[model samples]
Target: MDVLRYVAFATDASGGNPAGVVLDASGADEAAMLAVAAEVGYSETAFAVPRPDGGLDVRYFSPLAEVSFCGHATIATAVAHAREHGPGARDFHTRAGLVRVGTSVGADGVITAELVSVPPRSVPPAPDDLPELLAALRWSADELDPALPPRIAYAGAWHPVIAASTRQRLAALDYDMAALGDLMRRRDWTTVDLVWRESETVFHARNPFPPGGVVEDPATGAAAGAFGGYLRELGLVALPAELTIHQGDDMGRPSVLTVGIPADPAEGISVRGAAVPIPD
Candidate 1:
């Protein structure tokens, strides 16, 4: 199988999060996929096998292990499929659930893909999980934004949503990798979403993905989806809001993620972005 490289959430290859996409993985087994993911060395790699029912059976793997779903990888895979087949709506059956993705060409002929996440939910982290989590990140209780209280949000994968009161606090991310990784493994969290709200409709984000063996994710679509749900669940945003999330600037791989949060709580969140091919 050809492993294609694509960077999602950026118009150019220099930005966004890089992901490996395997258009055809029908013959490969779990071990082979894991090996490929490790070789790719990205935050996650997506393997897609076309189904007879017209959908694709997709799986996401990090360097270390497989995950239920991944947002950036899904976006990359959708763009790759669109470039090869055509741009339109497609269904993906993942370990998490069914994810519906749609691709469209813009006036500039750039292809942008949007993925609707599975129904999302958020809840307070277990009492025992919060203190340890904060300690690992070296963040104090007062440093957190009281308005956007902490919660563990899930769209496809689980992420702990922690909002910082100041942008500087969000940018200064020096967490204990080993401690965070162990906590994430025990809690089944894919990443830690550290965010700072710029306005009612704009935000800045940084993701620590120690569990995936990734120091940081330049852009995280899954966490964006979960963050949207977190805002909606906590009544933090007005209904039918559009949020722009800026991430990876400190890492120098800036990424922009557009999040659409519908009014209905049962509806899935929509995360949209443009992806580009990474030169070989």
Candidate 2:
């Protein structure tokens, strides 16, 4: 039903993570939305139904199942809405919580969207689950970064944050798809946030989204937001910091995501990126 394709977090259409946007899907049922998402076959498809108050009721669906939240799709949808309705602020009521998005056009005619996530929190992963996760990822304990440790972080969605001691380890991403998918489904994880810290403000990330039927996500804004929280919650980074995440380079569709962490621990993290339209 009139699906628009856009790549978020990249100025070029060939970069970033592609997402399907349905600006108006009020008439579609859950099954209909799911069918449409499958047809689009992107990592995620965002369906928006306008509310009477000028807000939107948004839902995200992958080819396989409905997701509580999706960052790149949200960025894509907000940018799409801005291009059609004019750049401004919009509120989205999602299954996870209320998300606030602000869009503006740069002098170069590029539109950037910034989303403030719901209050994020981080918790240590279940002890019993770490072994299975490590086995599925084919990573040894010694390969992990001692600073970041392993934890499940949640902003609008949940992701297990894993840090590699070196960029080389992070880049070697061969994993057991079936085992990871089964574990993710059982644990209800949206993605596995694999990261390598280049500096205090710079990082490289890769998201393995087996549950969504994707080998990897080029750019994952939700995971970035959650990672910001993870860093703040665990005192890994200074407060009121701005971090740059480089992702998808290994896949050749390079993407960049900017995350802003506030001083307040209870506040939501800000994820910002640009989305470009994919021509037909």
Candidate 3:
């Protein structure tokens, strides 16, 4: 299994989250995928096995365990696929659901990809669970933004959305990793979506993903998809609004995620970004 190491979100390799992409993993099984992910030591690794039906069966494995969906790996794998086969549309059957990706190269020679996420849904977190989550993150109720209430949102995976009133509160992240990981695993949450509103359609986010054995994700499309749902549910943005997500600035990776939310409630939101290879 040849692992293609690539960093997603940032044009330069050194500035984004690095992911392990196995372009061909026909011979590898679940055990092999787990082992390779651990060996690669990245937050997540993607294994793509081509199917006879012309689609691919994609699986995501973090250094610790398998996950339902991974945004960075999907972006990295799609870009890697486009680099070898020429930019175009592609499909993959992931653990979460069927995902479709469209790819193209710009005049500046940067490979860009936009993925239509599965239908998103949002629900309030269990009131009983919120206190535990708050404890793990050392967050008080007053620190939360009143406009964006806490909710558990899902597109491909579930995330508890927590909005801080200020960027300073979001930037000073010091959470109990083990405690939060335990809470997340028991509740089947993907990450803690800590965010700050910069404007009506622009926001800054930071995801604490201890369950994935990573401190944070530089660019998270799945979370962005769910975030759009959160905004729509709360009527935070106008109908048919386009949103921008700025993440990883605190980590120095500096990722930008674009979200296109349609007026229809059932339609999938679009997440667009560009990725490049990380030279080893």
Candidate 4:
């Protein structure tokens, strides 16, 4: 199988999150897919088999394990599909759910993709686990933003939403990887969505993905979708709002994600970004 590499959420290859896309993996088994993902060594890789109904059955695998859904990988795969065939909309049946993704070529020949996540949802953080969680991250309760309370948000995967009170607090991220990773694995959390709201419609984010065997994700699409749900559920933004998330800046691989929140709470959130090929 051919493994194509692309960086999602950024026009340049040096930015965004790199993902391995296997456009045709119909013959690959679970073990084979996992082995491929581990060899690629990205946060996640996508393996897709085209279905008879014109859709795709996609599976996501990190270096360590399989994840239900991955936003950046999805974006990269969709753009790769568009580049190979043509720009259009298609459904990706993932372990989490069926995600609809559309791709379009811009005037400058840049390919952009948008994925509509499954219906988003959120729940309050587990009171019994918050203390240990904070201890692992070395964050105190006072460092949290009062306006944006903590919540476990879900679009395709689970992510704990933690809002830092200041940009400095978010930037100073020196966490116990082993401690946080153990906590996250037990809690079944994909990543810790550490964020700082710069303005009403703009925010900065960092994602620690221990379960995926990655220290941090340069641009996490799934967490971005979940964060949109968190903001909508908390009434932090007006209905039918558009939000911009700046991520991977502190890591030096700057990436941008645009989120569109609809008025209907039951509707899925929309995440849009661009993907470019990464040279071997």
TM-score of 3: 0.97
Task: Give the lowest summed-lDDT range of ten residues in model 4.
Answer: 124-133
Clash-forming residue pairs, model 3: none
Q: What is the C-alpha local distance difference test score of each model? A: 0.96, 0.97, 0.89, 0.96
Can you write out model 3's per-residue Cα lDDT over 1-280, one digit (the tens) per residue?
8899988877888676789999889988899999999999988999999888767789999999999988878888999999988888888789889888888899999898888778889998897899999999999999999989999999889999999999999999999999999999999998888899999899999999999899888878789888998788778899998998999999988888888899899888788888998876
Higher-TM-score candidate of 2 and 3:
2
TM-score of 1: 0.99
Cα lDDT tens digits for candidate 2, 22-134: 99998899999999999999999999999999999999999999999999999999999999999999999999999999999999999999999999998888988889999
Clashing pairs in 4: none
**Weakest ten-residue segment in model 1 by summed lDDT:** 102-111
- Of the two candidates 1 and 3, the one with more favorable TM-score, higher being better, is 1
Runs in model 4 with CA error above 4 Å?
none
What digit string (tens of lDDT, one per residue) describes model 4 on residues 1-280? 8999999999999999999999999999999999999999999999999999988999999999999999999999999999999999999999999999999999999999999999999998788778888999999999999999889999999999999999999999999999999999998999999999999999999999988899999999999999998888889999999999999999999999999999899999999999999987
Per-residue lDDT of 65 in model 4:
95
Candidate of highest lDDT? 2
